[model samples]
Target: MRLPRPGEPRRQFVKRFLLLAAYSRVLTADWNGTLLAEIKPPKRPTFGMMRLRLSDFPALQNDFGSVRIGTSALTANNPLGLLYPILINRATQGQFYALLSECTHAGCAVRPYSKESGACVCPCHGSRYAIDGRRTAGPAFFPLLQYPIQFDGINTLSIELPDLPHEIEGSLVRTLPGAEFRLQLRFLAFAHLEYEVVFRASKTDDWRNVQFSLTPEAPLNRSFVSGADDYLNLYVEPAAGLGFFAVTIRILPV
Candidate 1:
């Protein structure tokens, strides 16, 4: 048998091996890192939104107080689930008008319009939207956005909404009641102190020395104070009927 030439170098042999791999569709590329990873889609189907106007509503011939205008999408996502309530107003003797379906604050669901208030009030967050979904009161800063609306030649109407306004117009908050009296308590943690709590019930300084024991229920006073005020480490006690007390505490700085 004839011997093959030894002139080919080891690098040339490696190059030939790579060429064979390429021809066989084998992968040999470096994998320092990847730019993108695989991703999965949401499980449920996302339906498009629809809208309608007053003229188009009559064509549907929906019963009064028995129709929901904004929840047809729910039928697609959740068959058995009921759509949210959309309060429609009576434009004429028998016709209906679509109103803002969601509340302005926190985007929580809104209840039926209160004829007395002339606004669609949210039972949750206490946001009130007008018949046009305008923000009337509560924490919402913006009005309810309407859906795309269309009308048929007849009274039938079609409405589509892309994404309902889920964002809140503003934060939810309430006014806090002002305290009748400002008391100060200054004393050691475990020391016994004479204290009497009273409620003036009015702005006057007249105090009622209420009698009570701290073992069962510690009481607060309408006037005077006794609590460590972050500085000055000190303590003070008062008489049993001490209607109100003012004690200064001394705290040694570390």
Candidate 2:
């Protein structure tokens, strides 16, 4: 949750944070109630190149028209989870440009370009970006990351994305009672990965792997939703004292 220390390398910082994140736990409260733990998902993976038909988005058909492609729609290609593709024209010539939706200032997702303001605005800090993803106003100084896109002069567009690590967003909700505890973890599962839920009685106790049951009683989908996707529910019947829980993920060999 904290930023990397000064002079720390990016790779080292990420590795350290991820190692700490896997073992972090929430202290038990005084009363028997529900506790919510915020688990930050890793970054989504990139599948090299993605192809999209311009006809699929009605807004991208005209000059200056734009559309936002979210992780829900891009379950297959997984192109950075959030993208803003805009139609830019010079005189009678028209072209398409794809911009990463994350704001440069604080990493908040930027909204679609507003025709009235003619810029994409960040809801968190009011950072404004032009139709071409250039920083136009507000606190951000750097432009949005732009993906290399090629238009076929017809209805198809090809976007090339750099290879990046794959990660998913997930949440853990826990309920504590008089003599038992329950945890419900919801996350997007990928094909070449494995997940495990672990528990500990207190901060000083060692974590032990716990058994869980899938909610849908079926397979999981690629698309991720907070309450949808796949839920791993673990119930400890004779749990004593305070309980701590965490989810650990592993990338399987291809």
Candidate 3:
């Protein structure tokens, strides 16, 4: 499949890419706040990702219909920390639902709404989601983004995620209480290209840019800190040639 050339606007690139992916449709947003397209999953959906070991979570063991929230265990030093306060629930024997604990409507973190109902409800607006992250109620019309799961018969449960963003806007980004942070970049090798990691402490903060080139000698990864809030954006320079990359960012606790 073809990818957007380097330097293309991120939203535009994602739009075109989503069109090309109509057959394997990835949910995305348009400016008017509408779904670009929808496709049925051919089977249980899955993606490549950093694995989180379930063995580390004893609270989830053998507890059917149980829901709990915890960090993805990705610290400032762990690129996979991009996903945090992950919601894990045991639906049945050998079955689990692991999803990002963020509201699909306004980027607010959601919490367990009701154990009996098996939903994660957003505190800001009352968007309710099922254990599988299906939006059972609105304010949030879209379902929650979930991580792929791989359970080893005995003691290891691995949460799988793509190196890329699940949804362009912060769907894969996690906000932790902190002033320090890090971002790891994994892109298709394009030695001549330069990329920028832009960010702000909050909605009102000015954007800051951290630029770097992708070279064979070493990868472009960075650590950052902001005294106010946490947020980020990625951009590719030269915008004309074919290029692709995935990044994971994590905030260090203060």
How does each model score on lDDT? Answer: 0.33, 0.46, 0.42
Question: Which model, 1 or 2, shows the larger lDDT?
Answer: 2
CA RMSD (A), model 2: 18.2
Assess every candidate by TM-score: 0.31, 0.43, 0.40
Q: Give the clash count for each candidate.
A: 33, 0, 4
lDDT of 2 by residue, 50-118 (tens): 556566455556666655543222222222223322222111256666777777887776766666678
Can you tell me which runs of candidate 1 are displaced by over 4 Å?
1-100, 163-254
Shift in Å, residue 35, candidate 3: 35
lDDT order, best first, reads: 2, 3, 1
lDDT of model 1, residue 8 = 30
**Per-residue alpha-carbon lDDT of candidate 1 for residues 1-254, written as tens digits (9 for 90 to 100):** 01112233323211000000000000222111100101122122332333333333332243232123331222222212123434454433444455544555554556544445776667667788765567888998887665444446455444343322111011111122442221122222212111223323343354344332222123432232232212222111223332322221111110
Weakest ten-residue segment in model 1 by summed lDDT: 15-24
Residue 137, model 3: Cα distance from true site in angstroms: 2.1
- The lDDT, on a scale of 0 to 1, for candidate 2 is 0.46
lDDT of 3 by residue, 1-254 (tens): 12343344434432111100100011222111111111122233444333334544444565433333332322222212333445666666687777776678987666633455557777778888887788998788899888777667676555554332233321111122442121223332211112234433443444455553323223234332221112334322322333233222222221
Minimal lDDT window, size 10, model 2: 16-25
